[model samples]
Target: MSEIEQLLRPELRGRTPYGAPQLDVDVRLNTNESSYPVPDAVVRAVSAELADELSGLNRYPDREFTALRTALADYLATQAGVSFDPEQLWAGNGSNEVLQHLVQAFGGPERTALGFTPAYSMHPIITETLGTRWVDGQRDAQTFDLTVESAVEQAGEVDPNLVFLCSPNNPTGSALPFEVIEAMLDAAPRALVVVDEAYAEFARPGTPTALSLLADHPRLVVTRTMSKAFTLAGGRLGYLAAAPGIIDALRLVRLPYHLSTPTQTVARIALEHADLLLETVEAIKAQRDRIVAELTALGLAPVPSDANFVLFGGLADAPATWQALLDDGVLVRDVGIAHHLRVTAGTPQETSRFLAAMSRLVPAHMMTKENP
Candidate 1:
């Protein structure tokens, strides 16, 4: 073994870092990012905010990120109808860092972190990297649904120290039933339950957020990111809402002055112009529905989605179809599912190009039988 490899932690010796391909293609939809660019007004506002803070770079940023936390709390109150005191909010470089902080605080040697399978891959990565045991629970084999019964049963069996629940889950693009969250809190009474809502802004109408349950459930934490709907992925700001006591626990593990002055300024300014920034949500949602409808019409089975992307099956070979689409200048995700691929709901033009590419590939790449 190489010197560095030999010195590395045994668990991380052969592990690859988490990343989706950042390919340069005509219609890139692999990652569930906003296809729309930041509006000119918000760009101008961020530029101004950063310009004003340039001189302050010499000093350390606010260790607590007070103003950003308040702005986030305000945004949550307005967007989700859940009021939160600033003390109930915490943020980090991205939701990933916030998640790591949670693992560091609650999960460590001999402790266990449990999550339903085919959910966020990072849940286990973060858990195991922190020396926590990872329990891979199951979802419905065909439908990928996690019922309250299944969740409670798994939690009771694993007795984990942390449990991850992803709403509008990645790879499948489906939201968890609310009852599952409640059942998890009850079943895993000793565990902290984290609901990753990175795509919450794109959920269909009438879908409820776990934020409403935070008041009564001290173990519940809902994480949201500016990377998806906020069109601020470059800003690298993600925050979560939980009981103030849980928030305090995270503070114990976070590095001092974690949020830079510029990062704090940019996020606060973006939150200030949230309405303008998020105006394209309906447009994106329209494209997401179009993808589902059109892919299904093409004889693929797209799981009903509440997020900004669609996961469709029925490919003869997902990797082959992925390459065919890539050759035609459209990029989608091959999420390691044998017969399935995922495409982000991009701008209308991008969606049209992706659909057109799929249409042309149907004769050779689409599954002929009902089940491939």
Candidate 2:
């Protein structure tokens, strides 16, 4: 082993860091980022907020981030139809940081964190790297569905200290049945159940958010980000809603002035102009459904999606098809599933480029019933 490798923490010694390919392609739809740019008015507001805060850079940011939390609470009340007090809100660099806070405070040596496989890849990475045992729970092999029965059973079996659940789950692009969230809370009574709702704004009508259950479930947490629907991926703001007690616990683990003045200003101002910023959500959803339809018509199988991406299958070789798409000036995610790839819903033009590339590769690159 190399000197650095030998000196690394034993658990992280050989693990690859989590990232998607950042290639230069005409249609870059690998990461599930909003393909839209910030609206001009929202940009100007953020700029103004930052300009006012620039003089205060020498002073540390508000350790409590009081105003940002209030803005976040108001946004949630408006968007989710669920009310929250500022005391119940927490913000960090990204949802990833909020998630890490959960682990750092509640998960550690000898503790266990559990998540169903093929969900967010970061759940396992974050859990294991923080000196916690990661239990790779299962979802249905054929449909990628997590039944309430299956989740309850696994949570009961592992008895983990933290459980990670993603709604409109990453890679699969489908929301968990809301029942699964409730069942998991009961199944793992001791575990803090975290629902990562990074794409909540893009959910199809009638989809429920865990935020609604936060009033009754103290152990429940729903994390959201400005990166996707808000079109502020560069702003690096993610926040969560949980019981006040859970929010209190996170403060114990967070660094002093963790939310910088600029980050706070950008996110708060973006929240104020959320309606203008989210104008593209419906357009992106249209493209998401279109990708599902087109992929299906081309004889590929796409999981119905509630998020701003589609996970399609029937590839003869996923990595080869990913390369083929990239070669055609488009890029998609080969999410390590045997014959499936995930593609983010981008602008209509980008969607056309990706579907055209996929259509060209079909029959040659796709799996037929005979192949299966």
> Against the unseen true structure, what C-alpha lDDT does each candidate score?
0.92, 0.92
RMSD of each: 1.2, 1.0
- In angstroms, how far off is 255's CA in candidate 2? 1.0
Query: Model 2, range 1-372, lDDT digits (tens) per residue?
Result: 999988898888878988888887788899888888888898888887788879879999899999999999999889889998999999999999999999999999999999998899999988989999999999999999999999988998899999999998998989999999999889998999999999989999999999999998999999999999988888889999999999999999999999998899889888889888889999999999999999999999999999999999998889899888888999889899999999999999999999888889988998876765
Model 2 quality (TM-score): 0.98
Please give each candidate's TM-score.
0.98, 0.98
Model 2 residue pairs with clashes = 168-175
Task: Tell me the tens digit of each residue's lDDT in model 1 across 291-340.
Answer: 99999898889999999999999888999999989999999999897789
For each of the candidates, give the backbone clash count. 0, 1
The superposed Cα distance between candidate 2 and the true structure at residue 272, in angstroms, equals 0.5
Compared with the true structure, model 1 gives a TM-score of 0.98
Worst 10 residues of 2 by lDDT: 363-372
